[model samples]
Target chain A: MTEQRILHGADMLTERGRAEWDAAGVQVSALVDNPYKKDFPLLATKPSLAFLDSAATAQRPAVVLDAQRNFYESMNANALRGLYKLSVEATEAINASRAHVARFLGLTDADARDIIFCRNASEALNIVASSYGGSVLAAGDEVCITIMEHHSNLIPWQQVCERAGAKLVYMYVGEDGVLTEEEMRAKIGPKTKVVSAAHVSNVLGVENDIKLLASIAHEFGAVMVVDGAQSVPHLQVNVRDLDVDFFAFSAHKAFGPLGIGVLWGRHELLEAMPPFLTGGEMIDSVTEQAAVWAPTPEKFEAGTQDAAGIFALDAALTYMEGVGYEAIQMRESALVHTCMHRLADLDFVRIIGPADPALHHGVISFNVCGIHPHDVSSILDMDNVAIRAGHHCAQPLLAHLGIESCCRASLAFYNDSADIDKLISGLQHVWSMFHGD
Target chain B: MGEGIYNAALMEHNAHPDYKYEMENPTHTHEGVNPSCGDDIILSLRVVDGIVEEAAFTGSGCAVSQASADIMADLITEEPVEEVKRLCELFLAMIRGEACEEELEDLGEAAELKSIALMPARVKCAELGWRTALTIIEEEL
Candidate 1:
């Protein structure tokens, strides 16, 4: 058992901590922590901590921070309403942000107006479920999704199907942690109206073939929507190349600010759907009895906008591009490879996803045998190693796997071999604590 | 080892607990779930003639929840129902670190759990059984 400390000292990276980390192989000179860690202020200041919960939310870089402050300091106004110069500047800033987000999603056929800003990815999904799904779905019609979907994507379609008297169908995966083509063909048939699934499972850490799914759905004349909350942060997603009708992701998960999200739909689709929320600025013309809605993006973005967050999201996309997708992909894959191998070496640990280490993209979920995930996470916390415990918001997948919950250690480009080493020592500490050393 | 939440006593109760079993013909039974962590418990109590004749739980949860439930069953069984309810309240307070020295002494084996207060995230884990027991009693009234 670890000796109980009477006091939690501040400034964790002391002389002794440096010595201890060195002894634990955390300070290997040839293999150091990422050069990008300094870009994120929290990682730079804390130094010794290993933050492994990037799937929930990522650390924002200094450029994103500066963009948020610059928005507030320079042009702080309700966008698209006033005739003043500051209001126009705010509107232009948001417009610029919309263009940037559209390009980030590779909106080749669509322009800035097709990009809608909601509170988060959940809200964006709800908009599609309420507006397009509510209009298209009818009795006996079916909506198809995978068994491995986050609650955000699942619940919206569920409620819409229930309200429209439509059937909700789920496609299942085999032991390999991916959906097969035959399964997709069998589930999405002529009765399917809409198809929605996560581009990558939050728990399984397997990237679903969105392009294949889109082509299959199109064969049956079903429109496709994608939950890119996990994919956008790790992989390069081109919505046009995939040909999905609508895609959604949260800004916070993409190393941007909170309280803002992106929902990019094809231009014609966005133009055809009715407004999701109606209020002050979304009106093109208004009367006491009736009203007219503004265009596609404005019709969805009702009420006051988070102009600062939008501006910050633009900067986040820029920062990610500056790092380049190829570099981010390479670094994260190497980190996950190292992380999974080290965790698999532990006798008590059981990796939940595919056996092949290359299959895991940027996330990995595992269980500590005979130990509760919460207990495992609690012990790891003592070592300043953070991990996510619980269902990872995918209860259906966990239930299918016959486990209550598991601990997830997701990675980003900023993590390195040092974090993996810390996690290895942390799990060993946990197992030794439960079963005497 | 004695100061932390995972003390020898708690670990013993978690590994080989006397209170983790099914109770047939239980007088009061209720299921409780901690939605945050997905920890759940099916608390069964056999209260007869104003005394808790037996108390048992059939469920799965973390070590803190399981051990805490077992220790609570050990303290409250064969005791008056009113005293059981009182001890449940005190156990909750002790887990929150709200009990003084005198009140802590009254809790017996459960008092060793006062160190759980240091972990704000696991506080709910320690209180799961006590909260389930309290709910059963309150529903009876």
Candidate 2:
């Protein structure tokens, strides 16, 4: 058997093209199977490997990897711990990363002081839900969110509402998988104490009207918290302009290292809100009887930080800035648009979310009639076409659609038209195998 | 994939299901679902003269699950009532790849699915039909 190479920029549906892609995808998988890279090695060794599961985790580039390595190799000290050169360097790196993230979100240095680092966006949301729910939420108040939230965004609020006497209210998304501004306004009223929503739904990919929602929440004196996990990675976000009281996102989703998250709160609000986690780094001074906490970001940080991961995140943001967020967004949007057109034309295939590309970002979920999502996913995998299957951690949305699961192919700036072609070809093969076409 | 893992004839039966719709007057019917992967199966059975006269199934899931149910139906229909119960036991053992020589003979092509043991995620899919059959038999008894 001759070893085959999948040619880049080739139409994947052609016989030679598909074989090449399959070979390439397998090659990439083999490369990723090894764990001793010590650097940002391709998750899969093969450049031709088709990985369509960006919704789960985006692949990190070499720049992000080098940043983390450089940090550990040089200034590997606890931030704010000592006056030594290494410690000062580590502290400066931490502050610089914070500033980079703040500028990326269009927040000032003072606003950056309110951005606390956590484990992931899920933990960031939990910090607000647990801390704010404990201090601010009273009996009879309602927390408003939409139907299309991941369990991470939903469960914490549910727990908070259960602990306090507060109620959890959800604004319903229409059949098109979009929540109307009117629907949001109706759901948020004087009783609504907090309004939290995903800026772009992880499953549907429909970008919500956050600025309008923020205004409505403000009208009712409720704090608006936006889950930027899906949005921050794909689009250029200006939290200051949107006026969201708190914003949360994961660095890994934006091609950064894992185990690092950002929780951006208003400076005054963070000062007033109690810290959820109490530990060494977050304290101002500790006495036998009483302890005062540090201000804003430090107060919320609580423990020794993920210094290396934070530095890597700053590198990730720098890469995005060099590429230009607008350009990345446009490229991904084009890829998604092409995917929607190709998949929607297939018989028995139904795209799951809003049909308008202008209304959404780069995520697409769909189901092939008479074919289980698992079957579709496995067949695609056999051809090295990676995609996500299941409810995507949004069970309520899946239940609403009367479907248990759907296959999702999410894209990033690194992906191009060739990826979409591979996905279409894989789906065609699955359709033929099932229907004997 | 091992031939001993799942009955090839059974998988074929699943792919080309014979009695896949509702039985006109089923003696009993049971719905089983795998919550983890969201596979659902509804098994309908008609027993006559202490034997399963007919078995039909309707559901949505992966090919392994849907096909497994079809194979299970083909194996037990029109067999002795006690024999059907014994066959169910053998099928469960086969899924676990624990069927002895004698037990393998009873399971027939269903034994070919032994490779399913290696793919733990597909175990529930392969057993969905068999589980429903057991539920129906237990309900009748």
Candidate 3:
């Protein structure tokens, strides 16, 4: 018995080669199939099931799952409480995980001490906005965010402004979906208390120049806060190099467990700011009248921590590091380029954001002519290809573009060129069916 | 077939739609849209002598909705405008899995869409065409 061998060449894109390529691309068995993966029971019954909705919630690898199981099976004790062996072991493991995450993000041990665990990115952002609004921001102060921000990033600032009598300002995204340095500078004025922006636009896949934005915020004495929910998972991010005052992202988005988020702030800022949630673990000494609070990160983490989730997050980060961020970024960028080129050939398809791979990451949002995004998505589902539709929580940005919704195919490290081909073929079918051509 | 339930004929027709094109000029036109799935259906009808003589549907949607629309336009024409309304009511009941045996016969092939009740998300797609028919009939009335 002989095994079959697949070959690749430079002429793979040629017309004669395309048929073979397309066949290779669309054939379900040739690609990775997860029939036994019962983790997603909802997808079990789906006719043609391929999970491409990683941007919404990435599927957890087995290692991350094991890490969570191991945590509960062996080290099941509350952290930082008793002087017993089990308590000390749990506390050490939690702190070590924090240190590992800090190092992964280029933070020093002292800087890692400033990292606070929260429920998710939304809660983390609110912690900063609410705490800053109460302690630092005053009446007439301004909070600047970008037009491409997710509602998670924008709404908190809006509420903060309304409560503190501050104004929320937005920087506009140009036709290309990239915010220019001039536009960023113009938005951050003297009264700006905070300049919070997404490192990468989830909808457009446009990568913002964080270094320049941080510098502009620093020039105006405004604290630079970055929502790295989209960026941290796909790119190599260094908090120290960016010189950001605060940064936050969710574990689930990075292929970890859900309900766990990481908030990394400057040591000095975390030390100065008052705790957002005060409870058992966060207290230093409690009396009948008042209580002194624990320092920095512990003060912010008030109640029983998501110990299992945090451990799983550490495993996810370790898995990502093992894969190497540079390789992941390169792989995803190539996938995005292939997707853009394939989609560009279609007459009715319009690729949102910068079409160039250099200007963006793996996220690609587009619309087919005379076809609604939901229809496009549903048609793809029938073909066993999956994608995300609707405003993608960027309603304001979508409204600015005069579109109700657009189809988005976000790629991750696991995605390959075959996935792009599936999307393109699926889209073609959708277009032909809609136009009856 | 009773007036309230969908028949096997109607369900078959919905699965393989006929008369899914526009006439040279339509007496009435209406657009039916489903915001959830963003399914849109534009129905054009030509009524003569109190009868729907010709009908066509032009829109972008899923297979179920588009096929359902095609079937609806074909079945309703050459019938009394009043009976078309009764058929639309019966089709709605069929999709809800509430149409009795007599009602099912009135709905014809549209009754085949009872399988859609199992997939709750697809119920809207199955009903888009019937809803469009009702809209056009309502305007004429």
Candidate 4:
């Protein structure tokens, strides 16, 4: 067994959780065969493909597709408008999906109406920046974010701060690509009003201690907003345990259908902010003079929602719960360990992210010394291995590291050791093509 | 070696580029950047009496960009500035999948890159250096 499997087994060996694991028959081992791939229909069609770009977006499972198809087949009607049977059933299914999604994130309080659905993580972050950050930020206020944030999270804050004449501050990572506590304290000061960052960096694949960051932000009277697009899919997240003010993620990255995302915020803060969009069902009362907006969640979601995607997201959460996060971690850690060790043996390969493979949950970024990353990926594509190569929308971080671009190989639970071997072999082919001088 | 994009001629130019260096006191110079992939190229020409006496380039990019720039530098040396511009326009047309009527004997090894038209994503990479050279003569001169 790998160290990750041992550690995972130890966490679940307690008397109470042991019974749950036993009842579920969850196998606590570094996955050798990729048992979860059978559920993902995309892999079945492309049998020869070695997909290493899960960080961009993951392949959807069959259950998620079936749920979406079933919604369109049976409950195909506009929700919240009609009183007929099909419309009512569609509305009920959507509402039930909302409840299920909330429960998946450990937001179980019946009275807490904190979940608001949107298009993707980008739109969700925009809601917080425009609606919440726009209303509160002013000339002297500062919005603090990390340098490793995706463009989606960074640009929205820049727009809001530029409009309000507030300062945009960045907490930078060190040479090892890990954000330290000392840097956080130095960057986040008394003037900080909103502290936003990624729970797990998309390129670096290193998880930040958001719980500690939230505590520190609270000490400075700043609200914490987390981009959980990369973190929530691979790890077990309890929103209440982190005590964050707002959290956002996408469904497509977590083996669900696309066009569905979520923004979860505390009820009081959400109620204090104005609506992000205003139309049809989002209005309580409308007149020629002025309009009264609806409640917290409905006020943020104005137009017609993607009901089919929401239903599929509910199925995705259920599927993840069935496989469990522990197994997911063990499987990915083994693959990372295998791939990183092989990559490290090559003299020309320079690995990014942390030194320890444990720190890199499922993503690893690397660069060949004399070869451009785009060339590396192009050669690898000929071998049917898909990887991402570019600045990866984190151009600021790449500039800080003094690199133009790099190649990234990210993993999902459906991946196994064979995928890692193919990635290594493909990289060798890239070397042979470029380094035969 | 795989046969499609990284052929032997392209790889030879990229491996040991004769003109891949900065020139001293060039008549014209231009830098081009591809923001999509962050590939950059600097084209420098030593022109004398309306002719390119010597040509050299310095930059970093993919195999396509580097090889195309090196081959373009070798072709433009000792040619008239007007002829260099014509060759650049012809090369751009070839990479854009247009029909080539002119005999590109002056282009030398660069004519072999006509197959680059099939790889649409890399057309910009192969054209960066030629475009930079054209920009220098058209605007700077």
Candidate with best lDDT = 1
Best by DockQ: 1
Which 10 consecutive residues of model 3 chain A have the lowest summed lDDT? A1-10
DockQ (C-alpha based) per candidate is: 0.55, 0.30, 0.13, 0.44
Q: Candidate 2 or 3, higher lDDT?
A: 2
Model 1 chain A poorest 10 in a row by lDDT: A4-13
Q: How would the candidate models be sorted by TM-score, starting from the highest? A: 1, 4, 2, 3
Candidate 3 Cα outliers beyond 4 Å, as residue runs: A1-50, B1-141
lDDT of 2 by residue, B1-141 (tens): 112332446436657887688788988888999986788998988887788889888987888788778777888889977887888888888777777777687776677777778767678888888888887777775
Q: What lDDT does candidate 2 reach at residue B5?
A: 31
Give residue A179's lDDT in candidate 3 (0 to 100): 93
Compared with the true structure, what per-residue lDDT tens digits does model 3 show for residues A1-437?
A: 01121222222233533443343344323223323234333444442455678787777777888889999899879888878988787887788889877987888766668889999998999989988656888899999999999999999898889888989998998778989988987889899989999999989888888899999999999999999999887888998899899999999999899999999998888888888988889988999999998987899999989888888888988888877887676556555555566677777899888866557676888888766676577667766788998778877788787777888888776665455656766776666554544
lDDT for residue A310 in candidate 1, whole number 0-100: 96
Per-model TM-score on C-alpha atoms: 0.93, 0.84, 0.77, 0.91
Candidate 1 lDDT score at position A320: 99
In order, the candidates keep a fraction of the true contacts of 0.64, 0.39, 0.11, 0.54
Model 2, residue B4: distance off in Å is 15
Give me the runs in candidate 1 sitting further than 4 Å from their true place.
A1-31, A108-110, B1-3
TM-score of chain A of each: 0.93, 0.90, 0.89, 0.92
Instruction: Give the whole-model CA lDDT for all candidates, comma-separated.
Output: 0.87, 0.81, 0.77, 0.85
Candidate 2 regions off by >4 Å? A1-40, A82-84, A287-290, B1-11, B19-30, B43-57, B76-106, B116-121, B130-141
Tens digits of per-residue lDDT for model 4 on A180-214? 89989998889999999999999999998899889
